[model samples]
Target: MNVTLTLALFIAAWALLDYLKPQFVANLEDNILSFLLAIITLVSFGQVVARYGFNTGWSAALEFNMLAFSWLILFGMSYGIRTRLHLGVDILLQKVGPQTAKMLGIFGGLLGAFYALIILDGAVLSIVGVDKEGGAITYFAKMYKVGIGVEEMKYPAFVQEMFGLKRPHVQRWVVLLILPISLGLLAYRCLQASWHIYTGQCGSLIAGHEAESLVEENRGALKD
Candidate 1:
């Protein structure tokens, strides 16, 4: 849920920036969130020290890893979308006339959909594996039942369960639950990009310099 919120915030911020400021948006369009996350990791280290004194539980490492992955994917995808660089065909499409370009775009989208399905399949398998293995980190294995709702410590509930205790128990890979949905969104975007190309419409959601280039292209096409 924390990862979900982090991703949501990043996307919302990305959308807002795309709406409000288009030119200067390139700064965050690349790696701002990564740097912010690095700062968060540094701060979390202090919190880890404060919470467990010298212990600094290993669970924090797992928790932080999840956070890092969540932010990286969220913001990285935002950057990719903004730049029109999400495994797309830009140069080849540009060389062709509008009709053929549009056809190729639709083909690209269908291809992307197939690839997304493969990724979704892998994600489902990985999630199932997590559930089957009932994996718990070393910290949880060591002090599982010892602490539960004691303070706002960041550890999986399964860790508590392993130690003969109970806490909030969602599925093991609950953090990754939204991944399928995000992949679905990626597929949808591919379809949308294809549609925009076919219809000779620059997509409303295309952002940053990509949006500017799209607008300029449309204008130039209208002149021709």
Candidate 2:
């Protein structure tokens, strides 16, 4: 469907931006996450203040918080990988020689990249709701065809009128748009890490030996 094609184009455009202006891409990601957190925090705080002070609160506050949290989590995957925050047990790497560990680390990174691709394809196929991939209509297409909007999350009246939509609520498909995008970012980070390891730029995958480093940093303090 056109919706899928458009989203795919957006993904490609994002990849291009990532290639050409990596710092801008990084700033964009950080800003998005920060904005989401700000929204969640402000909405939650307003709800609490209203409820306690005036015995009235926004009914949609909880739902809005949930939405913001979901977006944060979906988009945070790549950030975690980019910062090497996603750690794993490196027992085998520890036991092996440095060269062997390096290879194993590269293999692990490739595995992560493969896993991201698998998830991305599976999500697209599941959302498309067809036996096969090509020539299939996506769930977003179907939702648009029916023009169903989400519950408790409303668009501004002007937006509803401008779009000529029957309902004021935001669409479900729009909220879920982050899924594929997040997975794409995940795959890119994995491959990037793999390449770095292969080129002797990064030491290994999965932020190895973080606990050891933390312990070392605080060792003298504990004794004191």
Which number leads on TM-score? 2
In model 1, what are the clashing residue pairs, if there are any?
Answer: none
Model 1 CA deviation exceeding 4 Å by range = 1-59, 74-79, 82-89, 121-171, 203-224
Q: How far in Å is the alpha carbon of 69 misplaced in model 1?
A: 2.0
Candidate 2: regions farther than 4 A off:
2-8, 123-146, 214-224
TM-score of each: 0.46, 0.81
* Model 1 poorest ten-residue lDDT run: 131-140
Question: Per-residue lDDT for 1-224 in model 2, tens only?
Answer: 47646756776788799889989998998899999999999998999899999999988788878878988997898788777777788888889998998888888788887777656554544544744342212444666577677789898888888889787788876776776677777777788888888898877766668668878999999999
Clashes of 2: 0
Q: Name the lDDT of candidate 1.
A: 0.53
